[model samples]
Target: MSNTPLVQMIGIEKHFGGVRAVDHVSLDLYPGEVVGVLGHNGAGKSCLMRILAGAMLPNEGEIRVGGKTVTFADPNDAREAGIETIYQTLALADHLDAPSNLFLGRELKTRFGNLDDARMLEESRKVLARLNPNFKNLSDPVSSLSGGQRQVIAIARAIYFDTRVLIMDEPTAALGPSETAMVSDLIRQLRSEGIGILLVSHDMHDVFDLCDRVVVMNKGRLVGAHGIDEVTKDDVLSLIVKGELPADWSARNLEAAQ
Candidate 1:
């Protein structure tokens, strides 16, 4: 509920041997805002987010949460700082049940210092019900659920843990229209709950529909970031395809209008 940015990356630079994976990329995300990252393959969008989520270390640059600098050596560090990344493959254990998956690494402990099945189940049910009422039983395996249901579980897990920021990668990739709409509504619900989100998606429709701002990246460099009200789908396409703002895409117009 702070008015300050939930997360910010300034002049982030990362390299792999001789290759520069991230080049002077900068971004700021505010609480309850959904910032969409758009780029072609190899544009460094994923690499930059990986660094933010603490899945990978950056060669240079600084990350700040609520205006304080942080050094995250691992994803756990980011999680401890209230950041969550929902990847495409969803780091979920398909063999595990809903409650087990919800409390995977950080299990609720009982009074006797063992796994607290009741606490975990109760918490999981409450969170899931708030997010998705159809989350019938906590004993169901994820592999048996639909793609949207599985994603709902992952999102519910993050929300239950009080994560202030979420970085979702291609969340609607394999979902049907109805499923995508459900996820979209859930995203809005999270925003209303005061959680910031960094959404990475190739789907222009999703980006244009759900995001407040759109960031464009190309060849490991940030081309630009614009408010959704300022640009159209055509403008976003131009940025992604040309690696530069098109002549017709007036950033100044977008900026002033926005």
Candidate 2:
């Protein structure tokens, strides 16, 4: 890990009406590392991520990207700073083809300042080929692609832009084992490319298999952050339910079982 963090959240707090959705919380995401955000519903996992993604604003806090503290005025602000979020809905235009989806908001333009359909198609194919070779043609509408194919588009879109920090909300929430494996490989590829990632997921398998570290939350507060090898499934499960290290989860614990 580097001494400088890619993104850092310090004492973040937010609320909806009288309900405090996120209490003061601090966390850091490093380059080339995937940090899993794990918590039950209403544990403030999504709210915290929303603040960082600019889907929601925090009334009080500090966000630093690449060592400079900054505030995201909105989603565009975050996106301009090289932060891209892939929400659970996948958010792809069903009628659009893979290339159209890949370059949805951002597109390649011809010298005449018009959409360059051919170039977009070629680039989309290149990016997808790096991640999923079997991904169908870029000219085909996303609606015709399978779940895994759609996910490849979403991830390929983010990677093509070289997003510095990526946030995914429940990426594998609803997928078959095969689909899950495909997504998991994509994540490993992302990590290999040295992009920092924040993964919000409830699935232990997703976390253990793909994350370098795990950050847990409960009642809008950060409960703990531990290296993946430093914690076990049972310990992580306990933190999700009880909001702290399990009694048996010793800081010095070096399980020989692994």
Candidate 3:
């Protein structure tokens, strides 16, 4: 991972009328690293990520990409800024084939001004090969594919362009063990390629296994951040359940400050 943050959300706050969905949260994602964002339901983790992904607007905050401030009016704005988000839904066109879904909004055009099936399929093949070599159902509708195959389609779409930062929400949520392993391997591959990743997952084991660091949130506030090697599963669970960092974690943070 690079020393400079690929994306930074500082002092982010959001509210729905009288309810505070997010509150003064800050996070940093660095190149070639996966940072897991963990929190219980209604803890504002989704709201924070939505703001980062440009699906929702933050009431107060500054977002910096490559150390320069940026604003996301909508999801398209975020995408154009090289930020891609793969939600839990995968947001795929189930009736369409893998190649069609990969180029749903941004299809290639031939010289005569027609949908270029050959070009799309060829490009899809390249992206899919890099992400999932075992995927061979190019012509089959995504609905006919398995959970992991569908995920590969979504991820391929996000990464087809100049993707700098990727946000994955519960990537392995609906997958079986084998499918989950595939997604895990894909995540590592993307990280190795220098794509900053923010992984939003409720699965403790997934976060511990795949993330270089973890950020815990509670009641819309950031409770703590921990290195994977420095904190145990129990330490993270305590923060999620109680919004309190373990004593050892606190001591470590204090010592680092000193």
Report residue 158 deviation for candidate 3 (angstroms): 2.1
lDDT of 2 at 26: 93
Candidate 3 residue spans exceeding 4 A from truth: 251-258
Q: Write the per-residue lDDT of candidate 3 for residues 1-258, one digit (tens) a residue.
A: 668999999999999998888989989999999999999989999899889989999999999999999999989889988899898899998899999999987789999989999999999999999877798999998999988789889988988989989999998888888878878998898899999999999999899999999999999899988788878899999999999977687687677678
> Which one is best on TM-score?
1
Query: Candidate 1's residue-wise lDDT over 1-258, tens digit each?
Result: 467999999989999998988998889999889999999989999999899989999988999999999999998899999999888777789989989998988899977899998888898889888767877867978889878778878877777786899999998886778768878998898889888999999999888889999999998999989989888788889889888777866666856766
**Local distance difference test, per candidate?**
0.88, 0.87, 0.90
TM-score of each: 0.92, 0.91, 0.91
- Tens-digit per-residue lDDT, 1-258, candidate 2: 788999999999998999888999999998899999999999999899889988898989999999999889888889888899988888899999999998987889999999999999889888899877887667888899888788878878777885989999988776777767877887888788888999999889889989999999988988889999888898888889998887756634845544
Question: How many clashing pairs per prediction, in order?
Answer: 0, 0, 0
The C-alpha local distance difference test score for the whole of candidate 1 amounts to 0.88
Once fitted onto the true fold, the runs of candidate 1 whose alpha carbons sit more than 4 angstroms away are 1-3, 251-258
Ranking by lDDT: 3, 1, 2
The Cα error of candidate 2 at residue 27, in Å, is 0.8
Q: Total backbone clashes of model 2?
A: 0
Candidate 3 positional error at 45, Å: 1.3
